[model samples]
Target: MFEKVDPQYLLEGVDGFIQEEVSYNLFYLITGFEEALTIKSCDSKVLFAQSPRGNPWLWVNRDLPEEERENALKLLIEYLDETPLTGVSSEPRTAEMFANLYGARYHTSIKRRMDMEAYACPQVVKPEGVSGCLRSAQLGDVETVAQYLAGFSEDGYGIVVDPASQMEAAEIMVCKGGLYMWLVDDRPVSMAQIAHRSPRHGRINAVFTPRNERRKGYAGAVVSGLCSILLGEGLVPMLYADMVNPASNRAYQKIGFIQSGQISDIRFE
Candidate 1:
């Protein structure tokens, strides 16, 4: 039923879950390259809803009636009820009670939204015998950057993948930016993005450093550089740190990032 988001995007999330051979160039109507909530309705109906800081998040877009959206939700739930699922936005506080908001009912029981940010910059933390440089990422750097992301750990956020996660993961990374900087040998040790649709918002993403390269200031420098890039573009950068990783959060605070509020989400049958 999906008509807009490239089917390839939808399949990537699916591949992440099924861990099977994924075919490309497939577009989905509602679900795109990111994971879509997989639900096979046994008892309760499920919904997949989307929210954006703005319009450009959707590459090719369309709109449907509120009732149509609701029906789509009901159908999607019925279609994929057996699968574990997730949504990608900060849930509204009153989300659970609403029958329908954007395109789906607010599922209060679903897991809370993972951290999304406007932009974030960590305070300066000087590292001895180290130097860092930041700049926008380019096509030439994709292989190197991909290698770094391939090794990034969710650090305890429950996001993990084997060697198989490469394709879909890579596709999502491409939508990001050609503007990322690397530290030391011009390899991207940390990478983030300033949102295109929102002038005041930025997102820190794919901030990875090789395991052998951890504890150095490369991460901070790369993120700080990305923040400066966003600022230069006249935007404020925002990002989320794992509540569990006090060190990561603290590093950001040292570099001038502040916590506005915690984001929570949920789902229901």
Candidate 2:
């Protein structure tokens, strides 16, 4: 059976796991979110969590016997009986199993929304011959950043978003001091963000370079520069890349990121 547990329970013996595995579980590190829910199997082989801002996430310890893993998932579905969930995210197989069982129970159809590969960079391999240097984004860069944000959404996920609609988000990101720009000859050519810092790793996201700037190595330069900053602070850099985007994956790999695991995003319709 799965029982509701305090989020801190996840940290027990976490040191034994590599940072890549721990990155997916960082949602549990979010504290004092009244809407958050966390649960674990009695044997502690399976974990499920949901934060207000995201879909429910499942983590099944691969070391567990297959039969035990199946039983735990069954109990999890039962525990969530009638609970409304729009979707789930997890390592591919776990997400598929949970989505199938949950969809059957609710009579809903499941669709795979995205397949993402988690990556970690232990050492940065900055691209040479890139003229741009990394600088923290400021309020003056909001307009440019907004456009880049909109472009990132459309290009990376095929989502149509207006640049004006992203203005507020751009301002917030810039003000947070995590947003960065790769400036060449005083012009911003690429952008990236240090989305969040977990205990041992920092996540980089929103990497984008305009079509006109593509193939110029700006994306690699920006991401590698951010990785160096994180490393200076004693934190490893990690990010999730869309499995369908070979270009972005190759870029990250060129900068020293190693594929760690895969996560599937499934939606119920």
Q: Which candidate number would show the highest TM-score if scored against the true structure?
A: 2
List the candidates' TM-scores in order: 0.53, 0.93
- Local accuracy of candidate 1 as per-residue lDDT tens digits, 1-269: 43223323333333222211111011122243244322222221222334222111111111334465355545554443454344323223323322233225334344433432222433333334557676766666666655655566444455565534564555455656544655577555666554232323555656666777778767777777767766677665666555656677766776778665443333333
Error of 2 at 118 (Å): 0.9
lDDT of 2 by residue, 133-239 (tens): 88999899999999998998898778889999999999999998889999999999999999888778888989999999999999999999999999999998999
Model 2: ten consecutive residues of lowest lDDT: 14-23
lDDT of each: 0.45, 0.83
Clashes of each: 41, 0
What local lDDT score does residue 256 receive in model 1, on the 0 to 100 scale?
A: 78
